[model samples]
Target: MSKSKTTIAKPSVLSDFKEITKMRLALSVVFSSLAGYLLGVETVDFKTLTLLAFGGYFMVGASNAFNQIIEKDLDALMDRTKNRPIPAGHMSVNTAFIIATLFTILGIGILYTINKQTAMFGAISIFIYTCMYTPLKTKTPIAVFVGAIPGAIPFMLGWVAATNDFGIEPGTLFALQFFWQFPHFWAIGWFLYDDYKKGGFFMLPTGKQDKGTAVQCIMYTIWTILVSIVPVFGFTGRLQLSVVAMVLVLLAGLWMLYYAIGLFKKMTEKAAKQLMLVSVSYITLVQIIYVVDKFIR
Candidate 1:
């Protein structure tokens, strides 16, 4: 239940949850959904956008909460995640479950107010992230691929929510994000290889940060850039980017690829970190450019 309904939790207990939810990550996911909505809609609806943000945050937060609960044991084994609420004993599993349930209800309900498809996709994201991706981490590197499924949904979910269509337009948005996630995630896997190994999570292909991993990252970065430029060709039914947007997005992609290339050359953690930051910047900038280009042109 919401805080208003239950006895107020202790301050530090609340803080435990705030940390566990990964609020910044949740907000970033919401931003992608908002960008998709902006791009899909002919006339912007603030109400729908607000719903998208809130619903997206709650769903992603719920997924994160459940992931933490499931990974509590593994998290305790990893230095980076050892301080998290569940693994640190700052919060009980039951409390986390309640929070996750409440978020799910609120998220799906809010998205349902917009459309059934939106709500369905939101539920799917949570389910896949928590059920499939969370457990797969310890079993195989393919977990990253599984995780990318739900990770890439927000953008397409926004488009579906706005237009109630799951055609080439939304598919293009999904494709762009889906391919972008590999390079971004592999970079993190490259830097945090040892930390993840402590948790028994094999994120890199071949389970090592070597030429194979770097080569895959480069290939996916190329794929991401190519998909981002697809709208410029006017093949996608309902999506079209101005030539200006294509150029800007290409430049951003290259910026990310530069760091990827750096990682390939040095194979150093520092280079991997640079690639991660550049990937984050590239995605955010591309989303902003897509939305802005929608109106200016």
Candidate 2:
């Protein structure tokens, strides 16, 4: 009986770890960082690439862990977050804190090995996320804006890791990710509006599921597409995109924009969810296209 219980406890612990770190989300962030690194690199260095992947994951994980700790009570109040480790009573706040602290230290240490700029940006992402974004969620809808900063960093963080310099390339990458967040997150805010409200978190710009919010989603989707094509103009230095690549990127953006407009016309939860999924796919495809264009050029 004791041996059987030990096996069950092990799986439970692993599940709790995955939940605390938000494993899927962290991996996605790491992928963005790698894509950025690939776009910036003239020739790949697998060592630095590997380090960036692990470091990026650790940093995002740390931020998420800290977020869960700070929002434990609020998390319990919402269906979307109620099953998280701390809120579910599967892990202690102290244990989560320790894990977060360790991740912070390890992440920064690993990133610093690449360069000071990479580490600095990583640290800033964590600070903005845990200090500013998390608390502001309960106070105002502007939290989404603040949260976008950290959310946008991983892409540019890769460029900095690869080049160890701050330039127009990374800045453009940052802008692309930064603007992309509004539509993506607002779609999430639109569908999950009720769930978020239960936690006192207002994520939409107008703070309601009305025409006003839908309009903003369309507006930002336009802005994201515009920014995405900026590289084709030959003004973003090393970030230039071929005409073919630009056309492909435009098509992908338009695909997402269609869903954004659908949300405006339908104004239903289903439409919002569709926009959210398309926005996610749009960003991922854009990143992959950018990298492929770079090498093929």
Clashing pairs in 1: none
Which residue runs of candidate 2 sit more than 4 Å off their true CA positions?
A: 1-7
**After superposition on all CA atoms, what RMSD does each candidate show versus the true structure?**
4.0, 2.5
State the lDDT of candidate 1 residue by residue for 67-156, as single tens digits: 998999999998888878887777889988898899999999999998999999999999999999999999999999999999999999
**TM per prediction:** 0.95, 0.97
Supply candidate 2's per-residue lDDT for 214.
Answer: 94
Clashes of 2: 0
